[model samples]
Target: MTPQRWVYLRKLLSGFPSFPSSFSSCRPRVFSSSQSAADNMAEEAKKLAAYSAVDNNVQNNHVVGVGSGSTVVYAVDRLAERVRQEKLNIVCVPTSFQARQLILKHGLMLSDLERHPELDVAIDGADEVDSELTLIKGGGGCLTQEKIVAGCSKFFVVIADYRKDSDALGQQWKKGVPIEVIPMAYVPVSMTIAKHFGGEVSLRMAVSKAGPVVTDNSNFILDWKFEHTHNWKEVNTAIKMIPGVVETGLFVNMAQQAYFGMEDGSVKVRKAPVN
Candidate 1:
């Protein structure tokens, strides 16, 4: 919306004291005034971090990759806000069905990787982020698509709540490396993974369904709990050697930078380690 139009709207709205604050019925009800939202520290932090990422990096970002998961939800929301307020001409590429739904829900212009193969930047959430900015993602089973989208972006930026930032990737996110694999090969693949990595590999069971959780690609998910952390790139490479493995949650050196939302309503940014 233009400032002149905003001023006109404000004049029209000032007459009606009883009217709702927002006129857009399409917008989610969760967002209100920024100061009031800061009362909920965690949510505020997530919003602050997400908004900061979008505000700073989204300039001239014609093609953007929108990620799935909770934190990225805020990023999508902020993106939509910018689209409405500033009229940013950007097309969003979704990393998963969930992300696609968010794009549609917010009325953001949506496209696919086929249409925009290279993204100016990607905003994603991580299960865990280390000091070096190594990430553990795919907790939502969108790892394969997420990695693909991130890999195609000029800048892969991660946004998350403070709890996700840790001294090491495995320290905070204890769910283990989420691996996407073919259905029939899950057993053998799990066995192979355990044999080599010395971790308990288990098929991720669905809480709402009877059997294992499946990815958007209809592949089975295997959560491998390593006994401890090691060199991430080596670990990711070794796991990828298994014949049926599609992708692992271990995002080795993929992120260019990360924004962590702090409890005190502040945001912390960690750039990738200089190699």
Candidate 2:
């Protein structure tokens, strides 16, 4: 779907009753303010700080893209605090409905990529990150817009807990790389992914519902698990050549850097050379 049509589809989905009210409201009782949950969240918050340490470049009127995921909640909170304390004026873009809500709740100015074609920076979370900085994202089903914003940004900063870091992209995120595809093309796409990519491929099924997982863009998700990835760029190019593929989770050479928050609250930063 076109980006404009995807936005419209998200608006329509937002009106649906089945969609959870908010991330907080959807959480299970077990995680509600429990000591373990709080500690984990605190560590995640620290990770977010490490992620946002990118030079804000405030003079240029930064246009930032925020992504969706449990870990990214901390990044939103930190950004909100920064906005309040520094009185920073910036245009914030979102990769999902949840992200847009975060932008509003944090009092950051909302912007559409259509209005701002270029983005200064984007801070987001990944399902997994390899030593080379290739990533597996879209576990939250926002990969399409996330890729758009990350691709458009001058720098993309990824934030995650230590568990997400891996020697290779598919190792940590064993659920597989999430690929957004046209609903009708799922079978062909899955077959191609398996035959050519030499991976296990499956249509992501909704755990709560009986059908396939539907993305905010009204697309189906295919989770492809490759035992090892030799060339992420080649994998990305191959997937894009498939007619059904909308976007893939493999973020090859797109990230400028990453920050991983350890369980003990220490943050580690990794940087790539500027081209």
Kindly give the stretch of ten consecutive residues in candidate 2 with the minimal lDDT sum.
51-60
Q: Model 2, which residues run further than 4 Å from truth? A: 1-60, 273-275
Estimate, for each residue in 1-275, the C-alpha lDDT of model 1 and write its tens digit: 45643453444434433436576752343234222333345566788889899988897547999999988889998899999999789899999999999999999889998889999999999998888888888898899999999999999999988778899767888889999999999999999988988979999999998998989999999999889878889989988989999999888888999998876556888899889
Model 2 TM-score relative to the real fold = 0.81
Cα-based lDDT at residue 213, candidate 2: 89
**Candidate 2 clash pair list:** none
Segments in model 1 whose C-alpha atoms lie over 4 Å from true places: 1-39
- Model 2 whole-model lDDT (C-alpha atoms): 0.78
lDDT of 2 by residue, 1-275 (tens): 35643453444344334535566664554333344444544465455544455334232368888888877777777677777777777788899999999889878899998999898888888888888788889988889989998998888888887778898776767898899999999999999988887879999999998999899899999988887766889889889899999999989889878888754445677775455
RMSD of 1: 9.9
